[model samples]
Target: MDRLTNPIRPYAWGSTTAIPALLGVEPTGEPQAEMWMGAHPGAPSRVDRGAGEVPLSEVIAADPEGELGAAAVAKFGPALPFLFKILAAGAPLSLQVHPDLARAKEGFEDEERRGVPIDAGHRNYKDPNHKPELICALTHFDGLCGFRPPLEAADLLEGLGVDSLKPYVDLLRAHPVDAALREVLTAVLTADRAEMARTVADAAAAAERLGGPYAPYAGLVHHFPGDPGVIAAMLLNHVRLQPGEAMFLGAGVPHAYLDGLGVEIMANSDNVLRCGLTPKHVDVPELLEVVVFEPGEPAILRPEDEGEEVYETPIDEFRLSRYVLAPGAAPHSLPDTAPQILLCTAGRPRAGELTLAPGESVFVPAGETAVLSGAGTVFRATVVV
Candidate 1:
C-alpha cells in the first residue's frame, strides 16, 4: 500500500471552505475545487515508496500488469482506467455533455489529423475515451440532470411570463419529445446574445418572484446573468441529492453541478463539450450532435446497504462504494483482485498499517492485502473487473 499525495484543483466555481474543512487545514481564501486521486496524466496523484515520491502515472507505466492486475490491463489497456475525485462546487459548472466512445474516437482522430493543438481552447475531444461518471453527494448537492418532459418544461417557462420565452413555451407544447427538446435548446443556444441576456434577466426576476421550484434556477442566473446557459439550463431537470444519495451521468447527457460537495468518479478522460454557462468555447454544432434529445426524470441513486454499501453503475471502468465505520467494528477484508484507492472522509480509518484522517488516502496495488478498521467514513474506488 502506498500513501498517496493528491492534487487539488482551484477552479473559480469551487467552494472556498469545503475542501479545507475536509483536509483539516486552514483556507488559503481561494477556491479549492477538486482533490484528484488517480492517474489522469493532467494531474496524477503521487505515491511515496522507498525510492521517494513518484507520479502514479509513471508508477503504473513502469509495470502496468503488476500494479493494475492482469485482468484490468487486458480489459482497459496499460492504464488505471478510472479517476476518483472529491468535487466541491461553490457556483455552477458549465452546461456540458460528454461524447460516447465511438464519437469520442472519431472526434479525436479527426482533430489529430487536422493538427489541432491538444491544449487549444477550441479543442473538444481531449482523448479517445468516453467519460461515464457517478457522483455521490457528501452534502445536499444541487444539480441539473437530463431533461424534464416537454409539456412540464413548457408549463414552467409559461409561468415565467416573459414575452421572449413564449416562443419556447409554444415550441415545447407544440412538438413531440425529441423535436421539442432539440428545437427549444437550439433556439435558446442560437439566439442573439444580447436578446438572450435580456430574456435571462427577465426569467431571473420571475424565478426570484416565484421562489418555490424556481428558486434553484434563480441562483444560476445570479451567478452567470449574461450567460445563455442560464436559459439552456432551464431545459434540464433540476435535482437535489441529500447525503448518501448518488447520481449517474452517462454519455451525451446534458448536466451541471450547481452547488455543494460530492465524491465523483469517472473514466480516465477529459473530453467535455459545453452547452453554456462558461466563457470557454462552446461548439454548438458538436454539442447538438452529442446531446441525447430525450425527456425524463433524472435517476437519484441510493446505495444498496450491503455489509459494504455499494453505489451500482452500468460501466466497467469504475465502481464506487462506501463504508461508515462504527466504533469497535470488525475490519473489512477488501477485495484484492483489482487496484484500489481507499479515501477516508471522516474519523481515523486504518488502511493496512497506516492510520488515515479525513481527506487522506492510500493506493493499494492489485493483490495487496488491505484490512480497513477504525471509526470513519471510507469510500472505496476500484475497477469492476
Candidate 2:
C-alpha cells in the first residue's frame, strides 16, 4: 500500500472551502472543484517508494502485470479502468451527457483522423471509453438528473402562463413522453436568441409566483440569465440526496450537479457532449444524438448492507462500496484480487500500515490483502472481476 498525493482541480464553479474543510486544512481561497485519485494520465496521483516520488502512471507502465495484475492488463490494455474523485460543487456544473462506448470510439477516431488537437476546446472525445458514474452524497447534494414526466412539465409551464411557454405546454400535453421531451428540448436549444431572452425573463418572474417545482428553474435562471440551459433544465428531474444516498448516471443520461459535495467514481474517460450551463464547447447535434429522451423518476441508489454497504451498478469497469467503522469494531479485510483505491472521508482509519485521515487516500496493489481498522468512514474503489 502506498500513500497517494493527488491534485485538486480548480474550476470556477467549485467551492472555496468545501475540500479544505474535508482535509482539515486551512483554506487556500482558490476554488477547489475535484480531488482526483487515480492514474488518469491528465493528473495522475504521485506514489512514494522510499527513495523518491514518481507518477502513478509511470509506476504502472513500468510493470503492468505487477501493478495492475494479469487479468486487468489483459482486459484494459495496461491502464487503470476507473477514476475516483471527491467532487465539490459550490455553484453548478455543465448540463452534459456521456456517449456510449461505440459512440465514444467512433468520435475519438474521427477527431484523430481530422487532426484536431486533443486539448482543443471544441474536441468532444478525450478518450475512447464510456463513462458511467455514481455519486454518493457526503453532504446534502442537489442535481438535475434524467427527465420528469411530460404532464408534470406541462403543468409547470401552464402555471407559468408565459406567452412563449404556451407552445411548449401544448406540445407537452399533446404528445407522448418521448416525442414531447424531444420537441420541447429541441425548441429550447434551437430558439432564437432575442426571443428566448424575453421568454426567459418572463418565465423567471412567473416561476417566482408558482414556487414548488418551478422554484429551481428560477434559481437556475439567476445563475445563467438568458442561457437556454435554464429552459432545458425545467425538462429534467430535480433531485436532492441526503448523506449516504446516491445517484447513478448511465451513458446517454443527461445530468448536472447543482450543489454540495460527493464521492464520485467512474470509468476512466472524459468524453462529454455538453448541452449548456457552461462556457465550454456545446455541440447541439452531437448532444441530441447521445441523449436518451425517456422520461421517468430519477433512480436513487441505496446501498445493500452486507458487512459493507455495496453500491451496485451494471458495469464491469468499477465498483464502489462504503464501510463505516464504529468504535471497537473489528478490522475489515479488503479484497485482494484486484487493484484498489481506499479513501477516508471521516475520522482516522488505519489500512494495513497506512493511517488515513479525512480526505486522505492510499493505493493498494493487487494480490495484497489490507485490513482496515479504527473508527471512521472509508470508500473503496476497484474493478469487478
Spell out the clash pairs found in candidate 2: none
Q: Per model, how many backbone clashes are there?
A: 0, 0
Question: What TM-score fits each model?
Answer: 0.99, 0.97
Local error of candidate 2 at residue 144 (angstroms)? 0.5
Task: Give candidate 2's error at residue 15 in angstroms.
Answer: 0.8
RMSD (Å) per prediction = 0.9, 1.2
lDDT of each: 0.93, 0.90
lDDT of 1: 0.93
Off by over 4 Å in 2: none
lDDT of 2 by residue, 99-177 (tens): 9999999999999999999999999999889999999999999999998889988887778888898999999999878
lDDT of 1 by residue, 1-385 (tens): 9999999999999999999998999999999999999998999999988899999999999999999999999999999999999999999999999999999999999999999999999999989999999999999999999999999899999899999999999999999899999999999999999999999999999999999988889988777877889988888899999999999999999999999999999999999999999999999999999999998889888876855898889999999999999989999999999999999998998997999999999999998988999999999999988
